[model samples]
Target chain A: MLVIRRDLVDAMVAHARRDHPDEACGQIAGPEGSDRPERIIEMENAERSPTFYRFDAAEQLKVYREMQANDEEAVVIYHSHTATEAYPSRTDIKFANEPQAHYVLVSTRDPIEHELRSYRIVDGVVTEEPVKIIES
Target chain B: MAVTVSIPTILRTHTGGEKSVSATGTTLAEIIDDLENNHGGLKARLVKEGALHRFVNVYVNDEDVRFAGGLTAPVKDGDNVTILPAVAGG
Candidate 1:
């Protein structure tokens, strides 16, 4: 099971909506504790593409350092699907390198209509996991 | 019993454009071997010298096989195997 904050989901939806027609990507940071995951970071992907998203490694390193400084961790990595459902595409599965982190997908094909799903991907396998949105 | 394996677009050519196919095996390696026998170069596309290709991800029934048990992951009859490539755009 994955625990995400309601405010974090809202922020992700808004970002996806704002980048409609193109994919939007980001990283979700939270405490490592399982009972209460406090989302503490929001990152914007800089890669430009309608079909793909490439996270900025430098920015990611910065965030990682920041999280380390704060004693928090990067729990989930997220991206938006501009024209598809929250289910992962072939490419999404292929590129998943972090087996321990939750992969969240936001469907913004219909910006006004939002569909969010969380997954655990490793070695090309995608497993849908139950997600809990904590209200903050 | 056999398991159903789904091929992604990048590797469809190896499977002769077939999106999904069937193989018989109790473990992932056996099924992969069966696939290689049926489709030429399929094993190369997915595995290199016994290791999974860096760009290919294999999921069984929506669960990543790497985390489950890698090539030794158990496969039950009717299980679905999905192959996906790393998407790097956006």
Candidate 2:
């Protein structure tokens, strides 16, 4: 299960809503070996395509460096789907390099509502996990 | 000194079912060469036409190397190198 702050979930939902037709992507980092997600880092989708999302290569490099400097690791990697349900695509499973990270998907198919879910994509396998929202 | 390269599940056949393998090099290019020498067929899968395959994403210590220097990105001992395919689908 992935435990996240309610505010962070709201921020992600807002970001997904703001990027309506286009998909949004971002991540949360936490201290290494600690599954607690504490940092919300919004990322620019290089593709900007409604059906696809790729982190800007340069920006991704910088964020990784920052996480390393802070002795942290990406605990949750998230992206939004404008037209699909909150689930990992075959592609998402293939690109899931961080086996320890929770892959979160938010669907903004509805203008005013969103569907959020989390999963573990490890070794090309996908396992849905429960999300427990907490108060910060 | 060796750098640990994490192999995606689909490509583990090239590494003989190993999830990760240690190779020696000062740069990513050299590391690929080393991996190719040790694990045949991996280089062809990772690179095409003298460049990293467009569908592939390589990260050193979780940092994608394309922005750092691509194939020439410097690497050192004890670094973690990750190679994954670009995600697709909605």
Candidate 3:
């Protein structure tokens, strides 16, 4: 199961909500090999297309550098779906580079509630995992 | 100079299923050329029309190559280069 904090989940949901209609994307970094996501780094969707999202190349570079300097790894790479289920698409599976990181998908299709799910996309295979939201 | 290049699984068929391979080059483009020499049919999937394919993102030591200098980004011993596709779907 993928363990994460409630606040972080909320932050991701909020970011997805704020950028509703267009896909939202971001990263959550943690200490190397920790399998924990502690810091949320929001990234701009360069495409800004409701059906697609490519991180701004420059900002993506900066985020990776910052993580390197801090000795952290991108534990969770996340994006939202504005009109679809909280599941990865073929494009997402094709772009899954971080085999060890959790790929989170949030669906804000419902105005009242959002659907959040996590997956492990390794070797072009997508496997959904249980998420444990910490109360503390 | 020797550097490590991490290959995404989707494109591993060209590398004989090797996840990471070492090539010699002082620059990103050179390294890719070296890789193409060692692992034939790999460069075409990554480059198009004299530049990196639109969906490809190459990073040298965690820094995106597009901003560092595109394919001209420098590389040295022990550096890790990663190649990933620009992801999107909803």
Q: For residues B26-50, what per-residue lDDT tens digits would candidate 1 score against the true structure?
A: 9889889999999978888788778
True contacts kept of each: 0.29, 0.42, 0.51
Q: After best superposition, candidate 3 residue B53: deviation in angstroms? A: 2.3
lDDT of 3 at B87: 53
The list of candidate 2 runs beyond 4 A from truth reads B1-31, B38-45, B48-50, B57-89
> Each candidate: what lDDT?
0.75, 0.87, 0.88
lDDT for position A71 in model 1 = 69
Candidate topping DockQ: 3
Q: Cα deviation in Å at residue A33, candidate 3? A: 0.7
Rank all candidate structures by their TM-score, best first, as comma-separated numbers. 3, 2, 1
- TM-score versus the correct structure, for each prediction: 0.58, 0.75, 0.77
lDDT of 2 by residue, B1-90 (tens): 599998865688898899789999999999999999999999999999999988788999867787789999999899999886554335
Name the 10 consecutive residues with the lowest summed lDDT in model 3 chain B.
B81-90
State the lDDT of candidate 3 residue by residue for B1-90, as single tens digits. Answer: 899998865678889999799999999889999999999998998889888887887889868788888888899999999886565444
Which tens-of-lDDT digit does each residue in A89-133 have in candidate 1? 887886776676788898988747789999988778889999988
Candidate 2 at residue A30, lDDT? Answer: 95
Native-interface RMSD of candidate 1: 10.6
